[model samples]
Target: MKRRKAIRNIVLFSLGTGIIYSCKDKYEAIKQLHLKHLIIDTKQLDILDDLSRLIVPLQNIPELADHTALPFIMNMVEHVFEEKDRQAFMKGYQSWDQEILSIKGRAFSAMKIEEKQQLLSEVNEESLKASQELYTVFNTVKEKSIQYLTTSEYYQRKVNYYQMAPGKFKGDVLLVDLKNKNDE
Candidate 1:
């Protein structure tokens, strides 16, 4: 009887582990397929990745690139954004490249780290001060990018929320009276 129970427990544990592994594999496959179908331009995608890295750089913990946040951002832009907003975002994205070229006389990716930082700072300032459609679009994309990154599964898992234990509810539990305890 003891041997039979041991065998049953081992088999159940093995089966549970296999199921968990298979589910993880399936999820990754589905995510890859979704990314493949995304319609964003490749260069634009690279720019987004660079910007995301700048916005949320790696420190003691893993960065946006480690969690594949760029693809997630692209997926959001493709599916979550309204048509008009998507067009505006695309226009703003293109203007970012053009603006960089006009200011630095080279591609943004080719600039030095200090130069990139200065340029991004200028862009942020301009976005706040200017009321042009381009600036509005830039601000929209920046806000969305930050929002998506902070709320993403990877970020959540790496940060505090994942570590918190859920509290249990007990409807019939007697409430402790502090005054009674003091009297006792």
Candidate 2:
């Protein structure tokens, strides 16, 4: 009986692990397909990389590039943006790409980190010149990119940091304190 139970537990655990890995691989494949279809412009891709790194700055956590934030951002840009916003994004993307080409005749991704940072700084300055609503579009994209990359369960497991004391919620301390204070 003990041997049978142990065998059943092992089978269940193996099946669960297999399903989880399969789902992860499928999600990755879908993400890759989405990125491939979008063919995101070089400038937008560069901006996305910068934004992702900014939000999830390298520390104990891995860099955003190690995740798929850039492709995720591109997918969002392709589907979720309104037509006008999309056009605006394309314009900004092209202009940034052209600037890089004129400076180094290479894509922004190929540039050195310092050069990329400088270019992004310039792009940010240009974005600021736009109207508030227009500027907000880019900001929205940046925020969503970070949120999806960092918190999505498919990419990273969500951790609950809250530690609750046992029987703490049912304790009468709060009521007693309130009653005493009222009497006083």
Which candidate leads in TM-score? 1
Q: Candidate 2 regions off by >4 Å?
A: 1-31, 34-51, 54-60, 63-66, 100-111, 121-141, 154-184
Report how far residue 179 has shifted in candidate 1, in Å: 27
Q: Which pairs clash in model 2?
A: none
**Model 1, 1-184: lDDT tens per residue?**
9999997897686445321123334235224535322334445555666776665553324554444345455566667877777666666666666666765687776788787777778777774233254564456556766676667666676543443564864466444653353345
Give candidate 2's TM-score: 0.45
lDDT of 2 by residue, 1-184 (tens): 9999997897686545321123334245334544322334333554555655654543235533445455555556668877666666655554554545655677666677787666556546773243444344356556676676556553453242223453445345687785675456
Candidate 1 ranges with C-alpha deviation above 4 Å: 1-39, 58-60, 63-65, 127-141, 153-159, 162-165, 168-184
> Highest lDDT among the candidates is held by which one?
1
TM-score, every prediction:
0.55, 0.45
Q: Distance from true position, residue 109, model 1, in Å? A: 3.0
lDDT of all predictions: 0.57, 0.53
